[model samples]
Target: MTWLIFAFLNALFESLKDVFSKKGLRYCDEYLVSWALWFFADLVLLPSLFFMPIPELNARFWWALAIGGTLNSICAVLYIKAIKLSDLSITLPIVTFTPIFLFITSPLIVGEFPSAIDFVGVMAIVTGAYFLNLKQRSLGYLAPFRALMAEKGPRLMLVVAFLWSIAANFDKVGLENSSPLFWVISLFSFISVALFPLVVYKSRNFTGKLRRGWRSLALMGLAFAIAVSCQMQAVSMTLVVQAIAIKRTSVLMGVLWGALFFKEKGITERFLGASIMILGVVVMSLF
Candidate 1:
């Protein structure tokens, strides 16, 4: 498949993964569910080593893996925890904050400065995020921002966004020293291994939880594996922004699934808000 096709597939599978994860989270411990995402997916990815050549290790690759893998583990935990704690529509849309944070982080880390269009994109994203909670506008104009601050999930996701912004650059550094497929495999392996202690400590009945939610967890893991693989393939084939801009469409899918499957509240507004947020991301990418 071409990069565009893979990028679109990545978005579709990512949405499916999030929906399945939220479904599993309803019955399983969030920590265990988080572990299942990486653990089961790692199992699926392990056999691919026979088909692909192993990447040579370097200090840059190791440092990037250590930092990026640790942050990714933190993000995985926080992301699932947010799903457990808030409406899918609400929490998923908030992740759009990542690009917005990128506008700040990119210049500092990578020396990539934002353009005037970047400012406009940032404004558009902030506006969309505001409208996400427009259902609570009866309280005041600041209700949406207030809701973001008051909710534990949104607050945690906010931090997750910033961390991802930083980790993303390290991923590029890793890619500079290795192939994308190898990078994906190495990254996930490290994450699964690194998360072992925390997952075991935080989840008292991890095995039981995995058994209870095995089907959903398996589906979630399968989706994640495919999505991330496609993402890596897509990124390797084309501009990273092209792959990610398409992948961010997952936010819209999350909104749709939130309404149809989960029956979350305020679907219309959230969908509109997420669409706007995604559009802003597209603009950020194009500019």
Candidate 2:
């Protein structure tokens, strides 16, 4: 399959993962869900290790994994926290900004530069996000920005977006130094280990939460593994921006999922912003 096709698959699976995470978050603590995500994903994917050869490691590769894994732990926890606090449609669309930040970060971290056209795309994405807060524009034209700041979920997701911008470059570096499958497993393992202490402190009965909600949490983990694996493979075959730009389409899918599954309101508004953002992402990645 083509690299873009893998990217589309990554989008599909990522949306599904968000939906699953939201479902599990209904009864499970965000930290438990976060920990279970890496735990079960690494667990299910462990079997594939036997078939894939371990790539030779270097100091640079280890550094990338450590830094990326640390940032990933932060994003993972905040991601679940975002979903827990707001509607999936409302929060997920903000993640499209990762590509916008990637334009700047990739140049510095990975030596990839963007053209003027890509800057326009970034503006389109910003405008799209503005549309998401039209409901609160009663105060002023700029109330959307204020509204986003007021809403903790959107705010947290935006932080996650910025962190992901940094992580994307590290991901490209990691893939360059290691195979996709190997990188996924290794990175997940490192994050899982690094996050253990935080998870323990976040939940007094973390193991009990896992035991009680194993089935739902396992499903969440499964979807996460599939999405990440597909994304890594897509990135290996193309630029990180290209893969992530396509993957941000998951925000659109999240809008639909929120409407269909959760019967969440504001679908039209979210869709307007999400569709435009996805368009901007496409323009940014391809041009």
lDDT of each: 0.86, 0.87
The residue-by-residue lDDT of candidate 2 on 49-124, one tens digit each, is: 9998888999889999999999999999999999899899889988888878887798888898888898889888
lDDT string, candidate 1, 1-287, tens digits: 49999999999999999999999986688888888899888888889899988878899889988888998989989999988888888888788888777777778877877788877878888998888888789999898889867988788888888889988888888888888878888888988888788878988878787788899999999999999989888988998888899999999998889888988888888888888888888898987
How does candidate 2 fare on TM-score?
0.93
Off by over 4 Å in 1: none
Q: Enumerate clash totals for all models, in the order shown.
A: 0, 0
How does candidate 1 score on lDDT?
0.86
Question: Which prediction has the highest TM-score against the true structure?
Answer: 1
